[model samples]
Every structure is written in C-alpha cells, then in structure tokens.
Target: MAHPRQADLAGLIDALQAEGVEFIVVGGASAVLHGALAMTQDLDVVHRLTPENVARLATVLEGLDAFVREPAQRRLRPQAAHLSSGGQLNLLTSLGPLDLLGRLHDGRGYDELLAHSEVLTDGIHQVRVVDLPTLIEIKTTAGRAKDRIVVPMLLALLRERERH
Candidate 1:
C-alpha cells in the first residue's frame, strides 16, 4: 500500500532517456503537449519492443521501484519479458503511474508511432511525443469511453494547429 508521490514528467522522461530506454510519449500527456487542454495523472509511453530496449526499460523501472498496479499483482515486480511481450503494463512507480504499452491497437509499435511523432524538448530533456493526427487515430481506435471523450477536443486542437 505504498502510494508514492507523483514524480514530475520531466524527471521521468529524463530518467528513461538517461537509461537508454527507447519510447514514445502517448495518451493524454501527448494530447496536452499538443495543445489539447486535457489533464492526465499517469504518463503513458509506448516502449520499443527489443530485448536490449526492454532490458533498458527494466533497469529504469527497477531504479524507480516500479511495481504492477493490478491489485492481484501489486507485489509483482516488472521484468524485461513484460516489455517484450507486446501489450500494456500498468505500473506504479516511486514517481507515479506509468503505463508502458508495447504496442497500440492493431499492433502498432514504436517505429510506427515514432514515424508520426514530434520531438518535444522541455529545456532539459527531449522526448518523442505522438503527433496530434496519429494521437487522434489512436484515441479513435481505442474507443474506450475515456478515449472517446477526448476526440472532439483533440480534433479541435488539430484544427487550431492547422489554421496557424
């Protein structure tokens, strides 16, 4: 029952990149960065699915003292295999909730997402954030109630970006 305080996204991004864990920032965080005017407590990243990358991610997770968020597996520690498995991992780290997605719907991985991403620099650290169009595609495909709720906002943001 250890509820660690949420770590700032900059710190998390710096840590992950410092560890050489290849990933792309996605979900609500990306939306907000792309001017969607949304809020997200958790950081969602689509990590690369290579053994070396997974190993790197595992190292970063270990350093963060990350554990599974699921009640049934809260005590279970994450492993490199989890990253290599190509799915989503809901984890709670000393920093905060971090969702590591190995792939998105229909098995789109880092390479695919990265192709449609933009590098965002926060003065200290730089990370690839999914572009607004692709993020909209992802949200539309996800089709969850939460994902659906943000589509219009994202579309509006996209239109605004296009106008400028």
Candidate 2:
C-alpha cells in the first residue's frame, strides 16, 4: 500500500501523549527535534513494556488504524501481545509510518533511556525526546551507512548546542 509522502509526526505524538502512553521519541525524529537537518519518514518511539502501557499502546495503534507494514496484503493489526514483546514493530498507520520499539539497537528501553531524555513542550503537547548525546551514541553504535552518515551532522549539532 502506498503511504503518505510524509509522516504526520506531530499527530502521532499527540495521539500517544493523549493516550498517556509511556514512550520516548528516538531516532531521526528525535535528532530533528534537537536541531539536526536529518530527515525521517517515520516516528520511532521506545515504549515502556509494562502491561498497562502495552494495552494503551495497543489502543492507540488500533485507533490510528495501524497494521504491520510488511506483508501489505495481510494488514495484520498489532495486538497487546505484540507490544509486550521486546522488539520492534514497523507499522503503517493513518498518520504514516510509526515504528514502536521495545528497545534500541543497543538494548536500551524506555526506563533505561528515560533519565537521558527531556520532556519538551511546543506550547501544546509535552513529549519526551531522547537527548542528542544518546541519539548520537545509538546511531553511531548501529554503524549502518545511513546511521553513519548522520553522526557527523548530529555531532555538529551537539557542539553547536554546547556553545550556547
């Protein structure tokens, strides 16, 4: 199925925050929020693994009309069971691509990363976003070509932020 040219990241963030889902925005979106010029097609979040949070996440997923991005024909809707499992779920929602991760590539989860995150408000919703240092650490550790290319830019952003 063809997706929207761009993901409605704010809408997705609003939905998750509205539902009281415990999550921390990470990856490219987080980098962008931190003033990086990186572009992301999906909103990646690391959610708390508690049963209640999982249920809430499942509800939000259902409300968003989310389904497994792969096997486009199947269109499998994610369940609480899926959310509880510690891994990643690449989903296509009405808002666009939403990747719910149980943990990061280096095995960091919501609880672990929470201390390194900050709650930012755009005079609207208050969302927790991973710090640039942590984001840089994760991306650099991943070492994928795409991730590698962004590290330098993120480093520059971090340096610029430090100068202020």
Candidate 3:
C-alpha cells in the first residue's frame, strides 16, 4: 500500500469551490487556521452525502483518476473520495476510502457540517471550515489517537472561556 498524502490545500479548496463540488474543510488544517491546533499536511473534510452529491463528486473526480473503496472494519471512519493520481492525493476522512463507501455516521448532512463551520478566504475564493471547538467534538467523537490530543487542549480552552 502507498502512504497517503495531503488533500485539499487552501488553493485546491479554492479550486474545488470553483468546480462547484461542495466539501467542508476540517481536521488539523482547519484547526491551525482557527488558532486551536497546529499545522498539518493532511486535510480532512465532511460533506452531506446525498445521492446527487455523491454522483456529482464521483463524476468530477473521475476526470482526475480512479476512485477506490475499502471494506468497513473496526475504525471510526467515514465514506471517502480519493484522487487516483499516484503523485497527487488520497483523501482520508470519517467518510472512508470512497465517498459513498458506507452510510454516513448517523447520516450527518450538510446542515450539521454548516452548524460548526468557519469561513476562510484564499484570495477571491472562500471555503467553509470546521472550527476548533467543533473539530474537537467531531474528532473526540471519532476517538482516534491523534484526535485524543484535542481533548486536553479543548478542555483548556473551555476553561479559559469560562475564566473570562
């Protein structure tokens, strides 16, 4: 198997927006932007998976390369949408190895995605990103090792919020 590379940088997010493919910017990249997390090479995002959006994203990504799906296992994962380009990217999310890999966890949709989002601008294009507090909530709910770090930091921030 090949190592995963980062997907959806600011520039690419901008580009994806232009293409009209809806995605939410989440994980460490968004956390860094929100001043609650450090920099990250990988990018994670969640989208409202409807039959239409799924078909649209697949068509859009098909122009790039093949899309792959992995079987479900003992992991808090989501459906994934990946670019087949070997030198390019492999988007890993709660969404899984393919966008429509499995039903979304509790069928979380665009509204939930929007509820916890922060907007970021890269030049003229803007992207919606998941903010720190919500990211901590989402990641902690997922309960991954990397996400475990979000707990203490978030607790500190919450304490700080209360102190003020």
Candidate 4:
C-alpha cells in the first residue's frame, strides 16, 4: 500500500484523530495553526499517556510504520509499553517526523494543554492545537535558537488574536 508523503503532516493528524489518540498539536505547528508565518519539518504533539490513550497512540504509530528517529536507534519500532511509560518520542514515520511529547517543559500534560486548546481543521480533521500564548511559553522555556526565532512572531500573533 502507498503511504502519505513525508511532509504530509495533516495526514498524520487525521490518522491520529481517527484512532482517538488524545493529543495537542504544539510547537511550530501550533504556531502555524494560529496564523504565524513559520515553517516546520516536524509535527510536535503532546499526548495523554493514560494506558488507554497510549494503546490508541501505539496503534496509530504501528499503522504509520513509526520508529525512533535517532540515527543509531532508527530501526527500533515504538511499543505500547514504551509509549505508556511516556516522556518524549521522536519518530520518523511514513507520514512525517512526528514528535510525541508526554509532558511539557513545565510538566503540563495533555489534559492541561487540551483545556486551553482550540480545535483547528487540517482541511480534514479538527485537531486540537495549543493556544498561541501557551505555545510561546513552551518555546521560551525550551530556549532553543529555532524556538527563540519564532517567539516574537508567536507573541505578535497572540496580540493580534486578543485584539480581534
């Protein structure tokens, strides 16, 4: 069977939603959803790690042919046990680079982020994307150069959202 293009992030989102995986689209993708002009090669998601939710996530990962993205361990397939234990999973998948985060830098989980998220459509499924302000917080806390570059843009988007 054919697979989605490597850059087809929306296809991954649609699949995750279909599998009932509880996740919040965050990082650069969330910023883009809120109207920021930015480009990201990966989809960053914070997922709920409840055993049931992790099971659903594993099912999706299996369908996507997901495996660890790290160079040395790229062949290792994701297992439910590992996903359920949950920290961060950076996987190169048939769909794309899917970053599954179990907790935020500040230790917030999926439920917390979901409480503050909005459902945004990927031209297919209504995906839960983290709010702009929260996205900014995550980026700032992370303090990576790439994230720093986008902080101002996210702040501007937040302001723009507030004014409208």
Which window of 10 residues has the lowest lDDT sum in candidate 2?
A: 1-10
Write down the worst ten-residue block by lDDT for model 4: 1-10
User: What TM value does model 4 have?
Assistant: 0.90
Ranking by lDDT: 2, 1, 4, 3
Against the hidden reference, what TM-scores do the models get? 0.91, 0.94, 0.60, 0.90
RMSD of each: 1.9, 1.5, 7.6, 2.3
Which of 1 and 4 is the better model by lDDT? 1
lDDT of each: 0.85, 0.89, 0.53, 0.83
* Clashing pairs for predicted structure model 3, backbone only: 77-94, 78-94, 78-95, 78-96, 79-95, 79-96, 80-95, 80-98, 80-99
Evaluation by TM-score, superior candidate among 3 and 4? 4
Among the numbered candidates, top lDDT falls to 2
Q: lDDT tens string, model 4, 54-162? A: 9899899998888888762437888887786558888888887888888887888888888788888757568789877778888999999999999999888788878
User: Residue 73's C-alpha lDDT in candidate 1?
Assistant: 55
| lDDT value for model 4 | 0.83
Candidate structures ordered by TM-score, highest first? 2, 1, 4, 3
For residues 67-164, write the lDDT of model 2, one tens digit per residue: 99888679998988889988999999989999999988788899999999998777766789998888899998889898998999999988988999
Off by over 4 Å in 2: 1-5
Candidate 1 displacement at residue 6 in angstroms: 4.7
**Which pairs clash (backbone N, Cα, C closer than 3 Å) in model 2?**
none
For candidate 3, lDDT tens digit of each residue in 1-164?
Answer: 23244443554454445567666776666666555655466555564555656555555444434333233233322223322111123433321222321212444545666776778664675678765577677767878787687667766765776699
